[model samples]
Target chain A: MNEEENRPVRWNLDDNGVAELIMCDRERNNLFTDSFIDAFLGALSEIEKERPICLLISGLPDVFSGGADKETLLDLCDGKIVVKDLEISERLVAAPFPIVSAMQGHAVGGGLVIGLCSDVMVLARESRYGAVFMNLGFTPGMGTTELLPMAFGPFIASEMMLGGRMFRGSELAERGVPVNAIVPKADVYRRARRIALQIADKPVDSVYLLKYTLSSEKRKRLIDARRNEDLMHRITFPMPETRRRISEQYNE
Target chain B: MTKEEVIEVIKRNIVENLDDVEADSIDATKSMKEYGANSLDMIEVVSTSMRELNIKIPRSELAELGNIDELADKFMEYINKG
Candidate 1:
């Protein structure tokens, strides 16, 4: 089937002047795959064209995204697909309008990077957030290195990346990540939409310019992290240890 | 530097930066992907090439890159312009 008939991301311009891109890969916990990328790109194109005052990203209430799959990662190692083609981190960072993340579920793996890249984040107090890459015997990818330090402090970021720790949404807020709201799981999207509507009520140019002007620091960190993570991933993915880890996971 | 010499530098740098890469797989006309180069590897390769070759490539010019062939040509053009 063509992309439109089966796209995972659902897009709509709400009456409140906000553009909403909700992820609905119910079968996979919204795990990122090629189809997910295609759906996201298609949604991004629509958001760019419409230039809605602001954007909101939401997924299932239990899981923001399951993150990268091992099979696709093996594809990356095999030179079948470039991480650049995924473009989730860069696209979220460079989006012309303010992008808000309605994170109620766990933002694990690649989801963590995307969460930090967003302009504003309102996470559910009970939801989990983490960079669980190290536990899988590989370095994190998709710019988590740069972004974690920028969002969480360097100390926490390092522990999260190196030690594979998971934190509650309230913990991130306590760490000074400026969570716009820390509500219950069911309230995550409603609060995010309220915030998006507030942003949407502002002048479009004002919002875009504000995002561009202030996002430089975060963008720089993302670049540094994206490069370093990808480089380390290159070194680690081909190692026997990581390969064994992958095999172990498959047999499970 | 001659085009052949430049190509040689590119090949050496790729193999050095990426342990998985094989020297024999380096083709003058082929892109870095032929040697299993990813975006991250390519970034390091391009940076090393510029540093070793003493060339300054414009970011816009870098965006238009097609492959290693175009990259070498771009480096030569930058060198000639300098």
Candidate 2:
């Protein structure tokens, strides 16, 4: 089966002008496995072609994402599937519209990386955020190493990924994740919709131009960093320690 | 130590290490996540508890405990099991 068949991304442009990219696959907590990436890339392409005024990327209600699927990582230990996730993450960073992540709970590892690609992040106050790769014996993937340090600065991002620390939404907001507001879990989607509507209410051309203009400088650097990270991932995947760590975690 | 004393140690550890975990009265059954314990924090909690109680726990076993009471119970179990 093709990647999209296993995990599909749905796009719904509502009458109110909120373009929603809702991710399913709650079983793995919507970790954006390889299939999830394939479907999401396709959905993003469709949205770009249609020129949606504002975009809201969300997940199944309670969980935003638990990060990269470990089972999927194990399946492609040679970093084949991980590279695919990196490609999708780059596309998300370069998306034309103002992409807002409506994060609810447990954004970790690559999940937080994808959320960072957004123009604004609206988090549920009680949700958890982490750059969790180091704990799993892997480096940050999917542009996290680059975007995080750029967004959050070197020391903070180092503490997150290298220290394998996780912070609550309110804490992350204080630390500069652009978490504008927090509300009740039920209000996450509605809050995102309200933000999108506010953006849509503006003059479309000006909004589009502003979005492109702001992201242009950082976009190329991030895309290049993603390529470097992907190459490093391929090299790191074959190390004896990497194999032992994976075996230790999964084989038990 | 009294159970309250034990709870206090747990509370202090959580507040000191895990960001946003308030030092409020906590039910043992409440999720550690609800109390702002992430996976890394949980590992620290287990490791700290091991030093206090003198025990070693497999990380897999740590995954089975969900809340403060369950974590305390698992620590006790591991101590006795050892």
Candidate with maximal TM-score: 2
Query: Model 2, A152: alpha-carbon shift in Å?
Result: 2.4
Docking class of 1: incorrect
The lowest-lDDT stretch of 10 consecutive residues in candidate 2 chain A is: A243-252
For residues A1-252, write the lDDT of model 1, one tens digit per residue.
665536578888977668888887776667787778788878888889998889899887678886887778666655465664338888888888889899878788888777788888888765677788876678887778777777777888898889675666655666676556777778988888888888888899998899898888877877787778777877877777776665554442
lDDT of 2: 0.72
The sequence of per-residue lDDT tens digits that candidate 1 reaches over residues B1-82 is: 7887888888898786554566677777787776755443575578668988888664556766878888888888987887
Tell me which residue pairs clash in candidate 1.
none
Runs in model 1 with CA error above 4 Å?
Answer: A1-6, A79-81, A84-86, A173-177, A250-252, B1-82
> What TM-score does the predicted chain A of each candidate obtain versus native chain A?
0.91, 0.86
Stretches of candidate 2 off by over 4 Å are A1-8, A79-82, A174-178, A182-184, A247-252, B1-8, B15-24, B27-56, B66-70, B76-82
CAPRI level of candidate 2: acceptable
Question: Per-prediction TM-score, please?
Answer: 0.70, 0.80
Cα RMSD over interface residues, candidate 1: 18.2
Candidate 2: chain B TM-score against the reference chain B: 0.73
Candidate 1's DockQ: 0.01
User: Per-prediction fnat values?
Assistant: 0.00, 0.13
